[model samples]
Target: MKLFVYGTLLRGESNHHVLEGATLLFEGIKIQAKMYDTNIGYPAIELEEGSTIVGEVYEIQEYIWSSLDALEGYTGNPLTDMYSKEIVKVETNEGLIEVIVYTICDVSMKSVLIPSGNWIEYRSSLIR
Candidate 1:
């Protein structure tokens, strides 16, 4: 299976260690979804027509999903998990393809939206 990572799992980020052995299929890709800044020091994404969210696609080894699931706080319960793995089509240089991505689960309407879409850029701006 494949995974689309947007935030800390990007090339050079704090949580990127979780994907150490994963093969990067696409360095940059965009998801037609809305992005938001969560209070928990991470970004969140949701399916929204025409909206774009920048991320990376990787072809990971089998059994790595459990580690990813733990990092994403997904425990098979969509009702209370912070994120849930969902299959969505992302636009890459090669073409559009269906891939599993971890999206924010049961987010509140009051969450702040990240208009820039790119988490790395958005996160850097926060420090300045």
Candidate 2:
């Protein structure tokens, strides 16, 4: 299964260990979504129109789904989940493919908008 990761799960990020056995199929892929700084440690995204979000695509093992879901606070219940799993179209080198993405369920957590849409770039800028 293919997963679209935009925040901590991306390469060199804090929670990347969860994808240890996964293969990176694509990087810097842009999809229509609005990314925001949660004001905690990581970032969150909302599926929105007229916005682009930069993230990576990974081919993961079936067993990894459970771990990923848990880490993202997904319980298969939209009302209770912090993030809800959704299938969205992403443009890759090959073509547009549908991949699983976890979008923020609560908009209240979103504090700042990430204009660049690239979390890594936005994060690095904060350091320097």
Candidate 3:
């Protein structure tokens, strides 16, 4: 399955080890979503029209789903999960393809909007 990761799961970020052995399909891919800083070391996204968010796409193994779900606080229940998986189309060099992306389940948890929509860039800005 293809997974789109935009936060700590990205290259060089914390929690990236979860994707060990996965094949990177594309990087710096943009999708229609609004990103936020949960203020908890990772970022979350919400599907929003007219918004573009940057992320990476990877071809992950079936076994990785359990780890990814656990890390995202997803328990297969929308009412309880902090994040929920959604299928969305992303433009890649080859073409447009659908990938599973984790989106914020609770809007109230979003403390600040990440205007750049790129987590890595946003984090760098904080350090500078």
Top model by TM-score, which number? 3
Per-residue lDDT of model 2, residues 14-79, tens digit only: 999999899999998988999999989889999988999999999999989999999999998888
Runs of candidate 2 exceeding 4 Å displacement: none
**lDDT assessment of candidate 3:** 0.94
Instruction: List candidate 1 segments past 4 Å from native.
Output: none
Q: What do the candidate models score in CA lDDT, each in turn?
A: 0.86, 0.93, 0.94
TM-score of decoy 1: 0.92
lDDT of 3 by residue, 35-82 (tens): 999998999999998998998999999999999999999997999899
Output the number of the lDDT-best candidate. Answer: 3
> lDDT-based ranking, best first?
3, 2, 1
Model 3 ranges off by over 4 Å? none
TM-score per candidate, in order? 0.92, 0.96, 0.97
Residue pairs clashing in model 3 are none
Q: What CA root-mean-square deviation does each model show from the true structure?
A: 1.5, 0.8, 0.7
Candidate 3 RMSD to the real structure: 0.7
Clash counts for the predictions, in order: 0, 0, 0
- Cα error of candidate 1 at position 68, Å: 0.4
